[model samples]
Target: MRCFIFVVFLSSVAAWSEPFRPWLIAAYGDTTNQTDRYQMGNDNTVIDIYTNLMWESGFLNVSTINLANKNCVSLFKNGYSDWRVPTVHEIQSLLDYVNAPGINEDYFTSLPSNESVLVTSSSSLQPTDLVLVVQQQTRSISSQYPPDMNVRCVRGPQRTAPLDRYTKFQYADKNFVKDQATGIGWMTESSAIWFCDQAVDLSQVWTPTIKALFSLFNQSNSPLIDEAVFSLPSMLYLGSSTPVAGENGYLWAIDGSTGLFQTVPLLGPAMAYCATVQLD
Candidate 1:
């Protein structure tokens, strides 16, 4: 009896122990395009690929995949169901300190060859190239642009710094000198002007195209403002001790002053400078 009980306990434990299968089988359906198929390279899978690549490249620990299914809040895979669509903060985390590994362009390029077997109710047709083309287009548009500029035009009235020195304001608990950084209190079409609490130490911020920013903002729900903040085209920030003029390139500040600045690829190298005002 004792051995039998022990065996039963072990069986119960084994039953409970499950590994998380982060990957989910997703079906692509387009009623308008009349395209439906089980595509391997979808948004969720793309995100997974990025996550995996980043993790393998020593960028992250937990490989979390964002599920696109609305019906599934969270799913049990690999013995864990703590998975859900990443919050704005979580998505931001993925973007944090994202340099070297940059975007996994190679992963994107190789997607066509990674197609999985089609699983569909419609036996009349198999997945078509049109489906892949649509997916590729969507991804191309999304990955090509930055997130800041996309929402700028949609943002309400341009709150230009009427005065040189503006007061400081707080957004999401982050205090910022007003008007100094185009980043401060600027409105977007969706909401009022808000400052980013988590300002990067970098001197400039890059404004991506309005479309890019909108998609990223909507998808990630990041607290970082889409309008006004000076984001570096790439992720290069200068310290206060660094010389401002001619050291790197000239950056036009919010106060209409052009100073020496460094350029990074993250911010378009050609259009690098952004307006940053001095609060003090």
Candidate 2:
């Protein structure tokens, strides 16, 4: 079993003031358009060229984590036997931000229905109390295990991009300040508007264009920008100033835990920032 030291309950999404949509922050520059990184594979699987991860749409029909891991170990598929349960982060990468139910349907031949929740190999701070979850567009932390939770397997090394790909920014520790670094508090469009008007160097940090915001997670296969600098438990939802293409009165926010990106009301909460100086 994967033992982790961080545990967050479902209530974490709700806010003391307002629900701040979660998003991961990064320090680096430039983002490559991730349009063509996949190819179809046999045995109802899809291969991510960049991550070199072969995802099997099946090996499905397992309920518990133990059963899922056992199946992966004993089973072989598509001429490969190195399969294992995927981490929540790897599953998060498969989410399709532009599509509903948050997955790329064109590549994978099968997936759990929208109602079905997918479990990962990761453990919560309290392993028995929680586990990492992925379904549709959002990745979440859940205490209750659905009766028929689904499990999928992946094979190959965890691909990691070099640090040079993202824009570099510094942040105060998530301790005294909860604003941008931890994504724990409310920050709305008005705040971004205020920053833009003030002419701050990193003013665009909060309300950056879609490309700049997505660049944070798009640059890495793992959910985090830098594990050395941040802790998984400290991150929360982030709201971006970017507007959804067809949806009026809606802006995009990313769930830092699940890597889900979807629209929320413009006045709703979101926190995101990257800077050189400490956040006061």
Give the top-scoring candidate (lDDT): 2
Q: Model 1: per-residue lDDT, tens digit, 1-280?
A: 1100000000001121223221111101011111121123322232232112111111111111211212123333333333322221112212211122212333323113221111111100111111101011111111211111100000001111234433555433433444331333321212111111123642332232211221212212132222344332322232121112223432211111211123232222233121132211
- Measured against the true structure, the TM-scores of the candidates, in listed sequence, are 0.22, 0.54
- For each candidate, the alpha-carbon lDDT, in order, equals 0.20, 0.45
lDDT of 2 at 136: 46
Clash counts for the predictions, in order: 39, 17
- After the best TM-score superposition of candidate 2, give how far the Cα of residue 279 lies from its true spot, in angstroms: 25
Model 2 residue 269 CA deviation in Å? 3.0
In candidate 2, what are the lDDT values of residues 1-280, reduced to their tens digit?
3212111111111112222222232211112124676677877777775445678864366656667767666657787766766654455456544455445566653343444445543321111223644444332323334556556677655333333323333432222123332232222222332253244454433345332344344212454344433333333656555555457777666666655565667665555533222211
lDDT of 2 at 41: 81
Model 1 accuracy (lDDT, Cα): 0.20
Which stretches of candidate 1 lie above 4 Å from their native place? 1-74, 85-110, 113-280
